[model samples]
Target: MDVQSGLPRCSRHPDVETGIRCTRCEQPVCPSCMIPASVGFQCPDCVRGGSGTGHAPGANQPRTLVGGRLRTDGRAVTKVLMAVNLALFLAVHTAGDRLVDRLDLIGHAYYPVLGEVVGVAEGEWYRLFTSMFLHQDLVHFLFNMMGLWVIGGIVEPELGRGRFAALSLLSGLSGSALVYLLAPPNQPSLGASGMVYGLLGAWAVLARYRRSDMRPVVVFLGLNLLITFTRPDISWEAHVGGLVAGVLLTAAMVYAPRARRELVQYGACALVLLSVLGMVLVRTAVLL
Candidate 1:
């Protein structure tokens, strides 16, 4: 049993908790890192060792670090997310400020295009979700898409498609919720920076889990945080909120007990989502 986690950590992935051991080698193995054997489950190394005489190697299904089934193409969900962002960018370019007015995250603002008040405070709650995909500027779109491509590539493969998507959307929603609660009611914000920052937080958590050096990621995060605070027109609340949500969500995922991994992981996400909804309700009531 790991002294810190109080559970037997997987020998292959030290971050994962497990209750089982390989019959052949007696090394702890998580569900993903072990293969079913005749007598009992075997670790991958033992399965490959085969009969101890090196006669032939045994085959086994590949799994991600978190026990998710491996995919032929790990970046499929990332690609889809990018495509959706790109499509929305093009739509915003064509539709001009009108579409942005409709979708951007705002507390309460009167839009000439709609000839009425709008925003999350006005019961247009979908803006919290849609604003994440709406980038009105070319540079903003490019920067966010690049971040998504780079960070999502690493996180998606390990977390699998569904969990990765959930982390991203929930993080983005958390950012929007913060913006709604803190930013000026009429000051609108729209972009994927929240999601990008969330993924960055996920990356940092993953690196620490593997016992890798922390200096580089710490420096990178610090630089981004510096820019967030110093830069003009940046939504610092969104970045900070997404970072916190990502760290909590990923911790729940990577540290969950092997027996109840999926339930705990998804349940953590749902809890974050519920918290965001509560924020929206409170903020809306105050605005009204």
Candidate 2:
């Protein structure tokens, strides 16, 4: 029993004399105690009763969130957003054409008093957000909202509520800002097309980031971009602005290292918003 200062054999297999340590419990073990895993090996005892028995046990197993009806992640920001859009749609109808005239974005509104009240005139900016919720006609409204529901379903879970809301609002503002700068003044425009296009841009980029199949996204963007160029009476300028905002904002969110992810992402968002305002101010100075 004393071959090279033979110690007592394994606790479980005394006849087998070998020296190997359990990765988890760190007890002396023979070859028999080793359990193979994807990365290195575990001890028989550790494998039998999960990985961590010392601290908070089975902490990772349970689902933390039960997303929306479609998404089981325990979060329903997308659903809430859709509901809000629908409510606004109803409100727009209830308010009648007068509301559209007031809410729809334009480079300039003739009614300075109304514009001032709603932030649509000089130094007024509420139209940037309000316009995104308005629609010139029923068909236009449905088309844009359909795009929102489809894309929001895909993108929301990935970004979560806070970031999703930020993206939509900023993208919508950027769209209206561009329209204000480029489109003819006093010509009103409405609908969420700009925001929808922005979502498409961001979705395509994010899909590429995950190394997923990007053919469908690419095709969808191509078709929509084509339509934007061909369509008459459409503010194509807004589409361009929203697309640029979405792509850049998403890039900031996706590429940030894990060490300071939230800090960098939200910071980027704030900077983008400030840049939009800066652009608007410069445009206002030039026009007025």
Candidate 3:
């Protein structure tokens, strides 16, 4: 078979030679032209070689492989959380006190009449989820949103979007449950602070597991817990409950499935949930 004469043989195209050489690689190319890249036309061979391109000679590489992949793009999550908090703040402020009051009806409550936190409480016990999206005041909203932005950025990428969201909801519900059990009647609380604290708690736990330093996180948590205790208006119950829940949930998520490591996490979360439920039942019985 006169393979060379049958088709204009290009050095690169062994099967079907064409009278073309890659502009970049200067290698013979067949009917298929080189793939165009930012720099120039890269022949199939060059392209394949480039696929495994490592860091530039002097460029620094991560010590761990997971470091690069686990690094999260938390900007989107931060923006959305910020916008929601800001919008709620504006709505509460512009709509006037009555509107705010009405909205607070739907907020998570531990009791039938006293736990008004955010939205209209109908029969939807699921307001625990909705209450998370609501905020009481500008200061309250901004503070929580700020924490969300900061912590969400760190945690979302590590835990992934779905798990991060689940943790937030669970933390918030746990906080509200505590408030319902421990706080006085007619005391209203609303905001994402509980969830924020939860994230912090989760981070602390996760950091411990990943062999990352937890001192800074622990200091921050301690300071916040102190503030909650000192400040009369702040619900310590919610903060403590949420914080505990966050740590437990984080442990459950990060270490639970690996051997028997999750046993501690599972036990911790179960105990907290059951304790909160028991408290709620006791409160209800006493009130009734």
- Top candidate on TM-score is 1
Each candidate's lDDT (Cα)?
0.85, 0.71, 0.62
Off by over 4 Å in 2: 1-75, 111-119
Q: Write the per-residue lDDT of candidate 1 for residues 1-288, one digit (tens) a residue.
A: 636758788887889999897655556889998788654587877777544332233324444666565577989989998999999999988888888888899899888778999989888999999999999889989989998999999899878878898889988999999999999899999999899889989989998998889898899889999999999999998998889898998889899986798899979998999999998998999999
lDDT by residue (170-219, candidate 2, tens digit) is 88888888888778777788878878877887898789888999999989
**lDDT comparison, 1 vs 3, better candidate:** 1
State TM-scores per candidate: 0.81, 0.72, 0.62
TM-score comparison, 1 vs 2, better candidate = 1
Query: Which of the predicted structures, 1 or 3, would earn the higher TM-score when compared with the native?
Result: 1
Candidate order, lDDT descending = 1, 2, 3
**Candidate order, TM-score descending:** 1, 2, 3
Give the Cα error of residue 142 in candidate 2, in Å: 1.3
